[model samples]
Target: MKKTTFAFYRKTMLTMISLGLLLNCSALTFAEENSNTDENQQVQEEILVEQTEVLTEEVAVELQKEETVEQSNKSIQTPKVHFSIYFVAEANGEVTGQTKFDSLVSSDLFSNIVTAIPTPVANEGYEFSGWYWGNSYIGSTSSEVYSYFKRGAALSDLTITAKFKQVETPKVHFSIYFVAETNGELTGQTKFDSLVSSDLFSNIVTAIPTPVANEGYEFSGWYWGNSYIGSTSSEVYSYFKRGAALSDLTITAKFKQATPKFNVTVKFVTEGKGSLTGNVTFDSTTSDLFKDVVATMPTPVAEEGNTFDGWYLNGSLIGTTSQEVYTTLENTKLLESTEIVAKFVENTQAQDPITPPTDTPTTPPTAENPQPEQPVINEPVEPVVNNPGQAQQITPVAPEVQDETILDDATPEVINANNLDTIEEEVTPLALGHDSWSLINLVLTLGIAALAIMMVIGKKTTNDETRKVNKNAKVIGCITAVISIIIFILTQDMSNPMALVDKWTIVMLILGLVQVVTSFINYKVKENNEVESVNC
Candidate 1:
């Protein structure tokens, strides 16, 4: 019997050990499953982050490419053109330094060309003398040469020379004429160059073209290159082909005797468009351009309330308005509009005063006069006579009374009563002040809670330890929430009823929300743990 019992005991011990081993294996399995799930989630998050980065890089590259294309397109369009004029002087049958042409043609020429011409003096020459009258024809002593050719005269070769003398005061006496044509026909008989006396004179005719009929042509101050040929001098010339429509013309004139003063004028005549005119002065030292020579509409006037808005030339604002008007001293061929706009400002009124109630004033009283006091009187009162006959033959006498005295003690009592009333009045307002203090306390409480949460999260030792750490963190969060509520209640003042109620209501609501969230999270964590245990 003893042997049998020993064997049964040993078998039971083995069964117990096996059950323990099975439970250990089950726990290990659950842990491995949780770790696998965590690793899979981390991989998914990394993939999402990488995709976002790649998309961002692609957008940046596309934007860079678009900018490069825009820059390339801007590099391909055409540039503006510029022109100049110079005058060559002849003294004693030889050419002196070149000078800028300064003679006034039509106001149109001055307005268009004179203003647009750059520096009148050439960098390589001495001071520039203006255009002289004597050099009106080829081979003349003093002549004006234009650097730019008219559209129709692109193939023409023109030569001009002028003569000057200092005898009996400075003068610009000279003569000018053009070689008739390629056929050797001279337009005017004038001995300009010594080479014209020989057979080479015919060569001059071949090199220059004769004036053709109906090809609009005009000479400066002369019918056909004819001018005052004596001692005094005039500068500049106007030459045009017959019937040729003049569009953009730049004329520079120079004088040999006197410096000329001139003004520019622009006139417009359109088939249906109304006429418009503008004028400005010319500076001998600068170049000018005539952009928008004619305006499509009449000049606008500034309204009563508005100042000059901007300037417009042809119907468009060329630039903003300033005290100084805009001027173009160079490149005068292009024409556009200058625009003007009117500026107006709005008016404003002053603020009104606010009045407070007389009974409960916000301002304190000044310390000038002392407050008035209530008065008290000391007097002896006679007994009532109505009951005098009740006592039989009672002697008529004043009731025995102590010396009448005005006691100052009652005055102190009355003052104390007033002081108590003032204290009661201040207490209510002070309570409202306490409500404000409660709000500050609430903020500090939230800060402490956030700090505690961070500390708990930081103390977690391992991935598996997060559950225990989170459980304790929830308790701590609850405590913090309760503390915040207590602080709000204690600091709340009912004297200003709305003050304490409004402030603490908001804080209580927030703390309640926190409590709800913590409770839900704790419940979820517990449920999740239970599910894992059951599955194992």
Candidate 2:
């Protein structure tokens, strides 16, 4: 039983091992197939990705080409236009030829031409052919055209008939350039247009007309108001009339007037076109001719006293009672008037005194000589004077005289005169008053008061220490007191106030007051210091 069990176990083990190998092989094959399939799938996916990348690259290149084509189309679409026109004489008429123009179609020629063409009319048996030869089409849209036609035999003269149609009142500006040919023929060629001449037009037109004007019209001259017109063969004519009537012309009169007490001469000259007429009237109130003469003429005055008393005209002295006659040249009847005044000076000396005449005896003494011998009997006899004393006693007797005659003749009179000595003594005191004394007193009083106040205020402050206070106070007090004494001496009037007694009295009083105040303060401070020491 044991051996049989062993064989079955071995077979079972071998069968199990064989089954494991088969399973391993089947898994290996399945894994290999799956890996190969995955590798193929990866390769296929890589190819699809590369194809997508190539397609994307092709799409980008196409987009770039499309942009290039669009840009090229834009470049070709808006081309710059450049053109020029030239006038050429054809067989029968003048035609404008297009020398060069930008790329344009045939239909664009009509609008690009500068000139207009008129429709032909059939007259008689002649027919009008429209256009001869020329390609005038221009622009990209081909909406413009230009045509040229030759004149037929029916037309005798070639006339350029141009009718301007202002579709929008187009401001047509043109510029002409003249090209001189070698044969001395001048031709106008268009160079540019829309030229602005406002900056230099006035200066240019002020001189001569441009050469582009008609050759027949002559530009003559220009003035303030109007321009002159002239022809090639006739004289120039002015626009201003020669003699024109002026209305409401105002004439202003100006003349020189004399100033106060002075004469003036005026000379007139006209500036405007006119003649002045009128007499110049002058009044004595407004004119200074007579006033100036009177101011210059000297008046007469008394020689003895300061008084003006008379006047003289031309060396003729006028009396005080004479009428007020003015000096004038009116009666002289001269062409130019002149006045000559003579100044009169009166003699003011006192008049001479009159003398009285004394009476004398008119009768002659010779006829009365006979009566002299017959002396009067009543005449007293001559006294005999041989024996002196005794003869005098025997003299003839004389008649008695009246006492009343002596009394009425004369009386005694007494006269007294004042002495000059007392008068001079009295006038001396009145000449000098008390003006000096009042002035001196006022000055001295004010000066003394100011000095005393300065001394009190200039004292040292109370807050200073003892040594510093004493030193400063002494120095300041001495200086102030010395200055005050000096001021007192300078301002005092020594002559009037009893000399030293009155002048020094106020100064001594001020010094005494200062000393008293200083001494009292020093004593009080000393007592306070002593008390503080005892209490400590």
TM-score of each: 0.21, 0.18
Residues 1-536 of candidate 1 have per-residue lDDT tens digits of 64465457556655655665565556556657777677755665565556556655655565566567667866894432233334344553344344343323222232233333232322333333443434443221121223222222222122333443333432323222443322123233333332323323232223222222222222222123243322112211212322332222222111232222222343322221122233222222221234333223233343344343444445544444322223421234432222233222333333322222333222222232121122211111122123343222221221211111223546777888877844334343324445334444445566656654544454332236547846665676758665775655565553432432445556555665665566556555666666676787
lDDT values for all models: 0.39, 0.36
Q: Give the TM-score of candidate 1.
A: 0.21
Regions of candidate 2 where Cα sits further than 4 Å from its true position: 1-283, 287-464, 498-520, 533-536
Top-TM-score candidate index = 1
Error of 2 at 305 (Å): 25
**Candidate 1 runs further than 4 Å off:** 1-156, 159-410, 416-431, 434-467, 494-501, 504-510
Location of the lowest summed lDDT over 10 successive residues in candidate 2: 245-254
RMSD of each: 59.4, 35.7
